[model samples]
Target: MLFADDPGFPGLPDDFIQRGPAGIEAAAAALEHGKPIADIQQFACLPPFRRAGKILCVGLNFAAHAKEAGMATPDYPTVFARFNSGLVGHGQPLIRPRSSDQFDYESELAFIIGRRARYVSEESALDHVAGYSILNDGSIRDVQLRTPQWTIGKNFDGTGGFGPDFITADELPPGCEGLRMQGRHNGDVVQDTSLSDMIFGVKKLVAILSAAMTLEPGDVVATGTPSGVGLSFKPPRFLKPGDIFEVEIEKIGVLRNPVVAEA
Candidate 1:
């Protein structure tokens, strides 16, 4: 099944992803049958879970990134919220708001929850993940640092770049470890690291986050990016109009977006 309108898809309702592993199994079975979604490229690629209930993010989860930001690694996860208006799909433009010139790029791993989880333990946290995707945590640095809470700067319309494809959790290594994540700007590789460098792994994140809130199916979490953000550079190379940034994660795919100045 490819399109949202694939009603004939077996074993799931319209919001199939919310159905968890059963939904994935249905789709995988179709794929195995060589029933590839025809003319898929003719459609625009949106976030696989476009109607996600909550979009959560982590900051300072990568020790190197925390050090680069001149901040200490926190005892607890640095959690944040990203509203719907802030994110755009792959190939969409990432708007650099006129409010500030510190538009920057961050390439990171993101995952979708597949089960209801509240106060779940790390041992069972990964079982709740349905699939994983790539997220470009585009940033407006000046405004982001202006406040203790980064809500405003991070929530500008069309800044967060997400999607391309969502890979089933079974396809990737447990906790998405050993995968390499790369952030390329205008075809030049800027940020590079192993997913293993994450100070807080996926299981740890899911467990910690679920303790504070009930993580529902279809909720997405953009795991924090590593070091090499523009803010840490000597001259601070921020994104501008006409620039293109690409986030490529091993085994998943690349999520590429161009930079555009806000009208």
Candidate 2:
């Protein structure tokens, strides 16, 4: 089921299962509505969350990505938290923060929490998932490499470009393995890969994170990017004013954004 936070809290379209206000409430509501989910193409997309309490991001979740960066595969999941102030919508301008000279894009899949959860078992983690959305976890490669700490380079206002539409977790049909994630500049494809390469799947990520922190409704966890980041390329491809970047997650939707000079 899909819900929009537009001016009107519109009802779930005829094609969607109705989910209610609270994450689980909304899911239950969706099921009760007995409405077939409308084609997501029919209705406009909404931000994953109007506001989220926290946005946790994972790094190097893909082995190929780790190798591309000249780093060894992670000993364990590399986890970090992003500030909510960075969230932005699809097609929005991703301001190039003046504090850094290197900016890059990392295409990822993000999961929205349906309810409060702590120490949730992997078998039951899907129950707490509200749905899934796309994320362009933009980063400032310079700062990321400057210090051991990567937070400063990873989270910047307008850098978190996400959401054209979110589909309920249930709608993701079974046997739909290996999602293709790609990035484009103008019309050329720069990065492409299959989700099958992810070292840690969504279930395991939530299980590990839940053990360390309580994930509440609206919390988001970005699965992580594949190889082909600007910094990983020769001569390094970085975002500049007037440039446009588009991220596409197959079966979900596409998110397009233009680069702009930050004040």
Candidate 3:
């Protein structure tokens, strides 16, 4: 619910996800009766959480993706860190830094935590998930590979595309398996795969990550992308200015963004 709709609240607060399950349910109930915006489409859709907590991104969690990238199947999830500064809302422009022309795309399954969980068991991990969404997880090839550390290359402002909607966890199958995920560049399908193909599914990721650190409400765990990433092609099809990239997951609507050169 918008703060403008409720004067009891002063200004806007950025911690919607931190509201916990009960608060979230109350808000959802309130929004159900609120007057709908006649022109919501014209409004830029923000990422579901606005500012989600720790973005624990997993890498090489897809077997085919690891194979295509010439990496072996990881016995443990290759976790990485991502900041919200690099995220762009749906229909927003994803800046392609002029510093490099090797920008790439990754379409992955991302989920939000609904509970504060630590030392959670894999069998009980689903109870901690609030909802599921999509992550394009954009990458800067040369820079990403420059070092064993992917932080610098993975974080270019406006490269990542997030949101359009946040489908409640109950809406999807357990662990989001059986769903198809695809990535497109300017309407051309580049990557295609099934969610069941992930090396580390949602349950495992939640249990494993939370075991190391407390997984609080709103933390986003991106479950890695499949094969067919730009770098896997004979001649990489890196993104360029004027391009339109999309990440579409079955059951979850598509998230689209336009590409523009950094000024």
List per-prediction Cα lDDT, in the order shown: 0.85, 0.76, 0.85
RMSD of 2: 4.7
Which is the winner by TM-score between candidate 2 and candidate 3?
3
lDDT of 1 by residue, 42-153 (tens): 4446665667789999999889899989999988888888987788888888999988889988898999898989999999999999889999988888888999998787
Tens-digit lDDT track for model 3 on 1-263? 34565733322123545676766676666666656777443556767655666998999988888998999999999988999999888888889999999999999888999889999999899999988888889999999999999988999998998887788888899999899999998999998898999889999999999889999888899999988888888788988999999899998878888899999
Residue 254 C-alpha lDDT in model 2: 85
Per-prediction TM-score: 0.92, 0.83, 0.93
Better of 1 and 3 by TM-score: 3
Off by over 4 Å in 1: 1-14, 30-44
